[model samples]
Target chain A: MPELLPFAVSLKGTENAVRDGLAQAMACLAPLHLNTDDAGTVELVLAEALNNVVEHALASTPELTAIEIRGSHGADGLHITVIDCGAPMPDGTAPLAKTPNLDVETHDMPEGGFGWYLIHTLATDVKYSRVGAANHLSLQLPVGV
Target chain B: MELTSSTEHGLQIVTVQEPRIDAAVALAFKDRMRDTTEGGIDTVVLDLNHVQFIDSSGLGAIVAAMKNLAPDRKLILAGLTPTVDKVFRLTRMDSVFGVFPTVEAALTKLRA
Candidate 1:
């Protein structure tokens, strides 16, 4: 059977939109025939990446913001690019993925800040750039290789 | 987010009925958790057997639920699927929470 070519999904910058977009994106990758573990990895990475755009990049102007997710499968893996017409990443760069301090007391445990960490840990070749009025973040998942 | 709770062996076992716990329902999940766990039970066991996927927001909501019951009550996790377990392990939150392979195991160990 012939593989599905590159796919794209456009969504609004909202939580529900991200969820629906992810579902559509996963459906598009159905042709990849990824194993269970690999499929989970792809889902996780994409969720984190898209969530960041909705939460950070589009936080200020969510109503007017839009996100685009594009993906293609290759011998290396599944490469995904998330683009948004929102604010550029702080200082025009992606935040460093630092493991939060988990040794603290239970009351002081972090309730957030794990998004980038998960993305960086699970996805490779993560790159961020500001093209004109849009922010482009791309990464590769080591699946379907 | 939909959750159901029942008392078994004096433990409040709360089960998440949804499949994906991502940013979309993280807040709702946290609120539901708080409402479901508001009682005399000091230990609550979260059964995630039906949940197949969880994002960082969901992970953070779980952590928040634990913190909301900290110092007096406790939150235990059970029946983590592969993706859910991966999130917990990658964030090192697994070490923070007492995880069991099944709700029965958690109940057995706690009841013992």
Candidate 2:
């Protein structure tokens, strides 16, 4: 089984449309026999990434900014890579650090924590990288999805 | 999604329809909660059967409702599918809100 299938979508504005792209990814991976627990894991990882675009990936620009999504799935689990043209990451918050911990809420915490935090906990591997001008986040689910 | 409420055994059950519950609907959801409760109905229950996605703010709105309606009333969450459950858990809303499996179950428990 070739472990690579790709889906790419470019969405405009910070609408709920991001969920559609993600739901597609989850739908594709569902037939691969990932049990109930891992299925929930996949859903959270994708939702958090799509959500980042809605809340933080845009600036004072017209409400026309779009999110780019590229996803793939296979026997070892599903992998969805989200590429968003949001504000430049903050230093170490860049490339890929662990999704900040949202388990403990604090006043100084930035909007960046919970999304990445849930993605990190739900997936066996979560990586964020800045490529060109986009923030690319790759989330891996263990166990062939 | 629109949130509608009704009281059963002193429990206010708020039904939320639609797939995503985020910033746009968060306020409206909260308002309906307050409005209904202020109308002499407390013990709120949010029915999330139709809600497939919920963000931090959405989760926050629910939490806010709890704080705003405490003592006199409390918010209970019901029908959280796996996706919504994960959001609630990751955000720790699950800890703050009393979660139930169904609206009927929530009503029963709240009344007890």
- By TM-score, the best candidate is 1
lDDT for B60 (candidate 1): 93
lDDT of 1 by residue, B1-112 (tens): 8999998877889999999888999999999999998865569999999999999999999999999988788999999999899999999999999999999999899999
lDDT of 2 by residue, A25-142 (tens): 6666654666666666676666667766666667443266667767677666567777777775677352343544446433323333465656666677777778888788777777
Residue A13 error, candidate 1, Å: 0.9
**Residue by residue across B29-92, what tens digits does model 2's lDDT show?**
7787677668564577878999876765677667667767766666788999877887777666
Docking quality class, candidate 1: high
Give stretches of model 1 more than 4 Å off.
Answer: none
TM-score of each: 0.97, 0.79
lDDT of 1 at A66: 83
Question: All models, DockQ values?
Answer: 0.87, 0.29
lDDT for each residue of candidate 1 in A18-45, tens digit (9 for 90 to 100): 8889889999999888777888998999
Report the number of the highest-DockQ candidate.
Answer: 1
Worst 10 residues of 1 chain A by lDDT: A1-10
